[model samples]
Target: MNAIEIINLTKYYGKNRGIIDVSLQVKEKSIFGFIGPNGSGKSTTIRTILNLIHPSSGEAYIFGKNCEKEYNEILKDVGYLPSEVFYYSNMKVIDLLKYSASFYKKNCDDRINYLSKIMNLDLTKKIEDLSFGNKKKVGIVQALLHSPKLLILDEPTSGLDPLIQQNFFNLLKEENKKGMTIFFSSHVLSEVQKICDEVAIIKEGRIIKIEKINNINNNNYKRIKIEVNYKIDDTFFNNIEVTNLIKEKNIYTFMYKGEINSLITKLSKIDIINIWIDEPSLEEIFMHYYDEKM
Candidate 1:
């Protein structure tokens, strides 16, 4: 069974478009990445799925329950960490966490203490005294305290430092091992590439492509950079399979996805000083999708 299913989900705010006909399914026990640049409706899609914001059209399902109509029941097994963290300034971190835990039926004290130790959060400090990153830690603990079957995170690493970020990723992996489904939404490509089993690329509030990470990494796309003895025409390497082609002085760079022999055959005629070809990074592949004209 799919953990989450969004069917042609679309949302609008007044005249502004939130998402347009976005459809995707996240498999059970998998880490799914929803990637897009800022303001491309990543949050909107997530909000719609959680029924935090009503969709203008279409619907979403969580564990086979209608998200909009049965949100109360669905939320029991769902843990959510929004992009922004907020809390009462005067409340102690521990007190605030206790309050959040009260909403769920099970005891989360042990889970809370364990997560706080891992995240290095100071539960004794007042919420107002904590740094932004520390507050984010509190949010993280809150989200996981219930040991929810599904965890949804939006821009989770925004305020976390590198070491903490890796630790958090490790924690996520551990959770996944226990059969928890994770929905990770972020604009950063490398993190998504590293953590997600499958990723859906969103641009201008629409999903352009969805693929497994292995297929994306193992695909034949190559990052090619050529340095010739002299300047060359910009279109010299133009091909249907080439994207982001650019020429600056004696250097030419682009992403290619086709037969290597065909590319080398054309290069054989040119006076090349050096040529470099390597697998394209996920960021480059993301650019290739964004750089395309819609």
Candidate 2:
């Protein structure tokens, strides 16, 4: 069963464009990434899927059910963490969580307890007293308390520290392992790279590429770092299909997505002191799409 299906999904705010004919499928029990820069329609698409805002055209489905029409029914099995975290400021964390749990049918006490402990959340603290990061932790715990089958997160690590972010990613991986499908939307390419099984690159409100993680990391993309005997012009390295090229004095770094033979032949012509070519990070590959017209 597919986790989510968005077909020709377009949203417009009055005369302004949100997304245009956007379409994608997130497989069941997989970590799928929806990546783009700010104002690239990530939030618009997500809100449309959740039926928080009706689409201008086309449809969204979750677990084979129409999201707009059946949201009341479908949302029961869905967990969501928005890009921003907000809660009743006066309530204690435990109280807020319990109130949220009331909306679901199942008993989530054990689930909340376990998630809170692992997330290092102090439930006794009042929501008003918590820092931004702590508030985010509460949001995570509340979203997962019901053990929903579908998880939707948008820039979930915004206020979290590096250690907490890693812990959150590991928690998400564990949830995915247990057959919870995830739709993660973010501008942080590194975080998405660490966990997603597949990635869809969105540019100017349209998808430019949807590829498996392995294919993107291993094939058709290489991170090249070169130490040359002399300064190299940016245009000199432009002969090949390179995405992001940077030259700081004698060291040149960039991502290449063409035939290895071509890159090797080009490097052979130059007086190279040392060269290292390896798998390019998703961030490196994303820069190709990011630079397009907004």
Candidate 3:
């Protein structure tokens, strides 16, 4: 079953467009990545699905229930951490956590303590006195304490340090193993590539593409950098399917999308000094989509 399903989901703020005909499905117990540049409708689509904002037209479903009409029941099994987190500044971390727990029927004390230890959050600190990163830690703890079946996170790593981010990712993976579905939205493609099973790329308020991470990695696009004993004419690569060609003294660098054998045959003719070929990263693939006129 799909954990989340959005069908022709369009949202408009008066005359301004929020998202245009966006549709996608996130499989249950999987880590799905919603990625796009800033203002590309990532958050808009997320908010619409959560029923935080009414869609101009479209339907959002969470676990087969209408996200709008059945949100109260659905929310009990959903957890969300917005792009930017805010809380009552006067309360202590533990107090705020307990208050958040009060909304749920289950005791979150053990969950709270476990998450706090993993995130290295100080429960004694006041929300007003904590740094931005610390505040983010508080948000992380609160979101996970309830042990929701579905977790929706937007720009979740904003203020976290590297170590903390690693821990958070690990935590998500652990939860996923236990059947928690995660919807991770962010502009950071590298992290998305690291954890997501599939990704939907949005641009200009539309979903331009959706593909599995493995499919994207094996898409036959290669990033190649070669150094020759002597400077070679740029025309050497003109016959091949290449983009972003760069020449610096005796080295040539570019992206190639074609049969590897053809490239090897061409490379055999060059007096090569060194060569490097690697799969294009998610960020590089993301650029390929955004670079288009659409």
Best by TM-score: 3
Candidate 1 global CA lDDT score: 0.91
Q: Write the per-residue lDDT of candidate 3 for residues 1-294, one digit (tens) a residue.
A: 899999999999999989999999999999999999999999999898888999999899999999999999999999898888899999999999999999999999999999999999999999999999999999989889999999999999999999999999999999999999999999999999999999999988999999999988886578999998787876877888888788888788888888899899988998898999999888987887777544
Backbone clashes for every candidate come to 0, 0, 0
Off by over 4 Å in 2: 230-239, 292-294
Give TM per candidate: 0.94, 0.92, 0.96
> Per-residue CA lDDT of candidate 2, range 139-248, in tens?
99998999999999988999999988888999999999998999999999988888999999887788888999888887878888999878776678658777677778
Candidate 2 vs candidate 3: which has greater lDDT? 3
- Per-residue alpha-carbon lDDT of candidate 1 for residues 80-127, written as tens digits (9 for 90 to 100): 998999999899999999999999998999999999998988999999
Candidate 1 clashes: the total is: 0
Error of 2 at 130 (Å): 1.2
Candidate 1 regions with alpha-carbon error over 4 angstroms: 233-235
Q: What TM-score would candidate 1 get against the native?
A: 0.94
